[model samples]
Target chain A: MIADYGYVGLFLVFGIIFVAGALAVSWFLRPRAPSPEKNSCYECGEVIKGGSWIQFNVRYYLIALIFVVFDVEILFLIPWAVIFRELGFVAFVEMVVFIGVLIAGLVYAWKKGALEWQ
Target chain B: MIIPVLTLIIMLIVGAVVLGFIAVSAMFLIWWERKVSAHIQTRYGPMRVGWHGALQSVADVIKLLLKENITPSGVDRLSWWLAPFFAVVPVVMVFVCIPFGNIFGIELIARDLNIGILYIMALTSICVLGIFMAGWGSNNKYSLLGGMRSAAQIVSYEIPLVLAMVTAVMFAGSLSMQKIVEAQKGLWFVFQPNMAIAFAIFIIAGTAEVNRTPFDIPEAESELVAGFHTEYSGMKFAMFFLGEYTNMFVISALAATLFLGGWSGPFLPPVIWFLIKTYGLVTFMMWIRWTLPRVRVDQLMGFAWKVLTPVSFANLIVAGWILMK
Candidate 1:
């Protein structure tokens, strides 16, 4: 098991190396001519307006918040699901209850308009 | 000392093989997708490059590598420079857990971690961060919108994706990819009625997870000018392209392993079976990408949160109840 994790670490290192190596090779071969117009931010060929740091839609943030709640619920569900057969009827019922509560929460969120895009 | 040195050498070779596989697989998928999309539109895609444009992706890679590396002014140097690496590396890391079946009596996976599915899910989630970074770092309005949309879409669909996967885990009773495959040796999970729904949910949410059409609003070409990657050029853009196709492969491979029975078939080799199922799913995704129109952002979010999420949850409960009984 420990050695298996070692391979994972090795792969992580390998992944970084692969990306870095590709970039390095490209750098050595690629051109570096940077003109003012070329380096400016893209705005569909029009003159650059103000910066792109304006306020974003709150719906994105709202969706993320709801996702976090359901994601956490999923984190709990995975372990229970793996051991469901062994744990028998009681654990199954318990998980069903847990999931039911979360579903209610989802429904509540829906009714509250958290899921609506507009 | 001898053992440690031997292990180091083995690790090095495995790393190189995996790296080569990632590069080659991404290139092949890109070429395959072009051919698929072109045929759907009644046109020859890139017949000039090689026999039926087989070498088109290779030429494209060479061109991208040789092009100018443009760093737009007022961009965040750290995030901008690091975004491509961030995009490519996590997808690369996912190869560590993929079970490619045994060949010549040798198991071909890198490491079949006990938490294989969990590990993959976590790594894929991290991909959103890289995309968001690219959007923010570029200082381009379209990029930011693309990044934000990508983030929101991935997170929303992930609920159904995970729930659907959990249904499979429930049936398999193990999180390891190899164990899951072993459990399906007798009868693949997709054949069961409830598991069929689980499989459908997995595929649907998975298509969304990878940002393919009609869920590809994040990088909608017409709307966002390539979305979060609009400002990327040269090798950086190539990295993003590689990451996208590699992500598609990972999703397809996972679907194959969980539902279609990974590497288990009659007569032919296990690796061949695995590739056939995975590439079949990939081709399906490409076909859908070309055939369907992109959805409105509101419609996309509402569909994930409203329809897919609830159906998956109901399916999970029904599956759990049936299994318990």
Candidate 2:
């Protein structure tokens, strides 16, 4: 079974080599002249602003935190969903309860306006 | 213990063939997109190169090869250098499990792992990391914003995407892509009412995942100047382009296999059927891209959480209850 994943690994190696080979081939063919101005980062021809690695939006973090909760819910659901039939109807009700709890969490978040981007 | 040498050789051959397809298909899709978008815009694009400019992508590739590879100063050298490879490699890894149809004595899949669908989903999300690296490593404001928007968008849309996948897993009762395709043999999942909803959700979320129009807030060219790839040049930029088309193919192939009875039709060979369905979906996506304007970041993220996620969840429960009954 573990050997099955080896094909995936093999493909990854092939993909890496493909990109590297293309880049290497182009390296030989492509021009290499670069001035300081040519090497400068593009910013729509306006001289450089302050550093770009400044503080980001709080909303990105907010969305990420919310994503974590749902992502884990999905992780739990996959196993349950797969085996829910053999586990019987009781398992079905249990999932409803589980999803209900998550939906309630979503409602709570909605009430708090955490979903709002602005 | 020893692994069979024949199996290794066969896989190597298949890998090379897949690599060839990647190169050929990217060229085809570049030409196709140009023709499609041109017709939509009332213009004849690239007609002079070869029959309707079919060889236009070939010419473009030569140009790209001869173009300059400019590495800007002050960039994070390693990340900037490696980002294009990161963008591409994972998309290639997915083809191994995609069941292309049986030929000779074997299923044309490279290897049909038991966890194929899950594996594809997980590998695809890695693409955002590459984009984010391109943005951050470039040390440019627009690239950084593009990367950040992409990270936020993928994270939000992934919920509906995964949940929609769960719906398929529930119905198919397996994670293997081939088995999922086989399960749909008698009844294509899209034919069922609940599954039709799942298919809709899957395509919408998938469009977002690949960063196509209407969901293309991350790479909005008019706003972000080619977004995360602002600083990449020449062949490095070409790798990103190839990855986008290949990733589009991956998602469409999954949609075909999962919902459209993959590689299984009455008359024609299975691989041919598979190609038809997959390309049909790809063409549909390109049509949507040309027709719709890019959505704003607020609308893109909000639609994922509010509309798609909740509807898919409700649909999942309904499907589950019906399955129980």
Candidate 3:
């Protein structure tokens, strides 16, 4: 196990070195050329406009909120599903309850207009 | 003295073969992507050169090599160029854990580590960081946005991806790829009722992780115009291209090794079976890429966090309870 992790670590180091080396080589080999027009933000060659970093919609946050609820539920379900045959009726009952909780969240999202698109 | 020299020679030859395979496979996959996409859209793809454009990628490579390397002013020169190398190296490293055949057979794998799954997972994460660097270093706003999107997408999807794998690990009771493959000798994990759910989650998460279609908001060509690598040109761009294709191969191979019974089949060599299964998965990925419309960013995150996460978690609990009993 230790050796396995070590190999992964070695690979990471190699990755860093390779990337760093390439950048260094390119910096030296490539010619340096800078102009205001060249450095300007590219937007179909139109003249420069306002800042490009405005805040996006809040719906994205709502979607993330809904996702959190569901994602956790899925994590809880995988192991249960794996051993379902062995666990019998009792396990099934527990899973039903779990799914019930998830369904409630989905229903809640659906009702709250969270799932609707403009 | 002879034995040591012979061992050294063998090691060099093996390394060369592996590197050669990585390069050739990546090139072929690039060509295949263009051809497949062309056919899907009702157009002829690269039929001019080397029998139905087999050498088209080769021609493209030469062009990229001959093209002048451009460096934009005010960009972080070092990081801008380093990005591509960072993207490709981890992909090459992932092949080490893949078991192509049995011990008595070719066993084309580079290394078999006990924590193979985790190792690949960790290495793949570095690719994200590379993109991040590329975006920020390029001094371009579009590239920065693309990089940020990639980072967010990767972070969100990675959780479910790992969770899905946990289900397999819990069932197989091992983290080693070879051990995982061996566990499926009698029955592949995909056929298991509970494992089926996990497998589905894995496929979806894998697609997002590699930034492939519908989930490809990071590099949305229509929107970002090539995303984080927008400023790159020539051979540097090719490296990123190679990296992306290699990543696709890694994810497909991983899916095969984990759920489809890696290197286990009758009437064929294990390596051939493994490749066939892997390529099959790859082709499916390509199909999805061409068929589905690119999803909006909000929808992408919603699917990951809301749908996939909850389903995978529920699957996990069910797996745990079953194991307990």
Candidate 4:
């Protein structure tokens, strides 16, 4: 188990150092100019208009929700994919059924305008 | 025994070296990208730094080292500081399963876990979270939007990517990178009809996974203005840049190992052949980045879930049926 997580630990250490080092270096080098204009949300030099936290399109949320379902299905496919040659005919049939259901969901999304570009 | 200890020590040293190599390669690749873009657009690239700007990365490194790292006044200090760490760690971890050569296999591989492919897939997902943290922690709206877009894009394409991987695994009959490579001794998986479809899906998904061109909606320079890491500067920004490039190499290397007969060749050392194939894939990725235009976020997501996911899933079923006979 320890062996399994060795890379995780290494990653943690390096990640901390990189972030900390960056923060530390920026503290001393960059000029400390913090005027309201300097800190304002950048808008390509246009005057700040609406709040930055305005409501985003709901389409993104719909897309993400559908994505999660398909993504999980894909995960299930990985284990099946690795063992498919050995599982053979039984696995092939099982996968087809699985994909058939997912495809139905995809078609539903398509019909409901979940995939339409706004 | 003593051999185990020696092996452990050797693995640690080699792992460190590989991490350093990846960092250096990413920096060089950045400079190369700049020079290539400049030449493409008919402008001189880094002529002031050194002859052909070979030493530009080194200069950039020095400058970043000297640059001041700032913590935003209202930001979450801990997560803000930790974002870069999270960004880079998984990129390094993915290298373990890469079969560089026979003698240089580094077999212990940080963890000789049986489910190497699954492990890598999980680790890569963790990267999206880090990007989210960086964007949110920065307290910058553009950064936040970039992060959200990245999360959606990565999560969406990951389906096709995993499906494509599954097709390969189904044909290879094992999840271990070494086993998969070994299975390809006679003929690489890419040549297999089903695997060819899987490979195409994998490459497209891989491109999106690394947030490269066409799929680079997260960091759309024209719109998001540097995207999720917009607020990051100095070495912190460098870490994100390095992580992104390293992840690119990792995905490419894994693709090579799975489909291109990793470390298997006649003329040169196994490691050299493996690296040659890996870099060849990387160059292909670079070519795509240079040539393509960024896809809109909605179109990107639609293409993945609507198009890629279905095709890849169908490909898997087809592959399974073909293998069964």
Candidate 5:
């Protein structure tokens, strides 16, 4: 198992070098013609507005929170799903119960209007 | 020779081939998408370059390479400079595990990692971090909005996508791509009733994952003026574009592997079968991209959270029950 992950590490290092090479090629060939106006952020021909990274809606964060909850559910479910056939009905029931809990969470999120976009 | 030197030689060979595949396929897919979208709109796509514009992407690449690399003022130079690599490198890492084919009774895969499917999914998600960094690093409001939208969209859709993948994991009993393909030797998973549902959900969620039309709120030209990539130009923009198309290929290849049975067919060679199925899905995605319009942000979020996630979760549970019995 450790050996398997060793390849991932090697792949990652090589990948970074390869991407850097692609960028280096572009850097060598691409022109350098920066100007005050050219370097400004594009706004469809409009002048600069307020800061771009200002506070936005809270709904996205809510959705992200809900996703995390389900993500954890999945982490538990994957092992169950992988070994599912060998475990038979007992594991099936266990998974159903586990899913039932998540479903309840989903329903609560739904009723709470956490899923609502508006 | 030392063991480390031997390993290094093997890695060098594999890395070159995989990177070459990525670079070549990205160029081809760009030209192909243009032709497909052009024909969809009833226009001549690229007639001037090499045999009906097949070489158009080659020319485009040259132009991008020669164009000025613009670093917009007021940007966080660190993330700005590194964003393209972040967008690309992870995707390239995924190629290591993909089973391209078997030749002379030897598998053509790079590394064939045991945790292939999980590893690919994990790496693909990291591309979102790069996009967010690009938006934040550029110090542009539209880029930020685009980046945030991408984050929201990707996160919301990932559940259904993973759940859909889990169905296949259940059927195959392994996460290795080659084993998944081998498991489907008897029958492709998409043929099963529940597996069909999983396949459908996978495609829908996969479409959203890649941020194509109907799910492309992040880079909606009409709304965000190129969205998270609004501030990027020239070669940097090219990198993003290449990453997006290559990502499209990766997901399609995943779909092909899980549902359609990677590299499996009669008469044709294994690699050909794999490419055919992979590119067929790629073409279908292009068709959908051209056929559909972008959805509202609310509608997109609603679809993922309200509909897809629930249905896929239920599907997973049901598939599990049936398999268990």
Candidate 6:
């Protein structure tokens, strides 16, 4: 297991280096031309107005919060799913109940209108 | 203690090979998608570069290389500089565990980690961070909106995606990619009713995860300019392209392995079988991309949270009940 992870680590290191190396090579070959207009953030050819960073919708955060709850729930289910067959009916029942609790949460989220996009 | 010299050398060789494969595969898929989309629309795609624009991607790469690398004013320097690397590197790292069948009795995978599927899920999830960074770093309104949309979209769809994979893992009784394939030797999982649902869910959620069309509201050009990558130019933009197409490949390959019986076939070599299945699914994705219109963001989120999640969870529970009995 340790050695398996070692290969993954090796790949991770190599991948970062490879991307960085490509960028460095491009830096040497590419031109260095710049102007204020060229450097401005893209806004479909209109004079830049207010700051681009504005307070956005809270719905994005709400959706993110709901996602976290379910994502964590799914993560917990994975290990159980891997060895599920071996554990048989009793374990299956246990998981059904576990999932039932989560379903309740989902239903509550639904009823509360947390899932609504508006 | 000393590093194993032969193993290190072998790994370096493998890394170089995989890197080459990623570059070539991305280029080919880009060309193929254009052709597929064009032919669907009843027009010829690129035909100038090489025999029907076969070398178009190569020329494009060169053009990008020679172009200036622009760092827009008022951008977050650190994240802006690193976003491309973040986008490309994690996707590249996922090539580590992908089983490419065998050649001459040697397994083509870099290392068959026991937690193969889990590892892939983890790595691919990191891709969202890169897009988010690019958007935030660019200090552009469209990029920010695109980034936020993607983060929300990917996270929402991931539940169904994971649920589908978990169903496969339950059947296989292992998380290793090779083991999952081996479990399907007698019959492909797609042949089963519940597994078929799982397969459908996987493909749908996988498409959304990669931010493809129909589910591609994140980069919906009609609304968000170029989306999270609006400020990206030249090679940095190319890296995002590489990451997107490569991601399409990875998701298709995973679908092939988990649902389609992987490289297993009687008449052909395993590698040939694997590529055929993977690319077939990829073509199916492209066909869908060109055929369907992009979904509205509210509908996209509603579909994931309301429709896919509930249906997939119910499928998983039902599949488990069948397995236990």
Q: After superposition, how far is residue B239 of candidate 6 from its true place, in Å?
A: 0.7
Model 2, range B20-129, lDDT digits (tens) per residue?
99889888988999999999999998999989999999999999999999998889988998899889999999888989998665678888898888888788889988
**Model 6 spans > 4 angstroms off:** B1-3
Compared with the true structure, what per-residue lDDT tens digits does model 5 show for residues A29-87? Answer: 87787788888888777777866767888987888899889888888887877778888
lDDT of 4 by residue, A51-77 (tens): 544576787788778877876777777
Off by over 4 Å in 2: B1-3
TM-scores for every predicted model: 0.99, 0.97, 0.81, 0.90, 0.97, 0.98
As for candidate 3, its interface RMSD to one decimal place is 5.2
Question: Alpha carbon lDDT of residue B101, candidate 6?
Answer: 94
Error of 4 at B242 (Å): 1.1
- Which of 1 and 3 is ahead in lDDT? 1
User: Residues B1-325, candidate 3, lDDT per residue (tens digit)?
Assistant: 9976775566555555665777788899989988999999999888998999999988987776665566666578788867887788888778668787654556666668866776777677778877888887877777888987887788778777877787788778776788889999999999988888988888899999999997999899998988998888766887788889888888888889888998899998888899999888988999999999999987887776668766876787777666667
The per-model lDDT (C-alpha) reads 0.92, 0.90, 0.77, 0.78, 0.87, 0.91
Sorted on lDDT, best first, the list reads 1, 6, 2, 5, 4, 3
Candidate 4 docking quality: incorrect, acceptable, medium or high: acceptable
Q: Model 4 Cα RMSD, Å? A: 2.8
Off by over 4 Å in 5: A1-3, B2-4
- Order of candidate numbers by DockQ, starting with the best: 1, 2, 6, 5, 4, 3
Report the error of model 4 at residue A50, Å. 6.2
List ranges where model 4 is wrong by over 4 Å. Answer: A11-37, A45-51, B1-8, B42-44, B76-78, B103-111
- Model 1 - which docking category? high
Cα lDDT tens digits, model 5, B153-216, are: 9999999999998899999999888999999999999999999999999999999998998788
Residue B229 CA error for candidate 6 (Å)?
0.3
Tens-digit per-residue lDDT, B47-119, candidate 1: 9998999999999999998999899999988999889988999998899989999899989998889999999
Residue B96, candidate 5: alpha-carbon lDDT: 75
Candidate 3 residue spans exceeding 4 A from truth:
A1-41, A47-118, B1-12
Mind sharing the TM-score for model 1? Answer: 0.99
lDDT tens digits, residues B188-268, model 6?
A: 999999999999999999999999999999899888998999999888999899989999999999999999999997889
Q: Give the better candidate number (1 or 2) by lDDT.
A: 1
Instruction: List each candidate's DockQ score.
Output: 0.89, 0.82, 0.18, 0.47, 0.72, 0.81
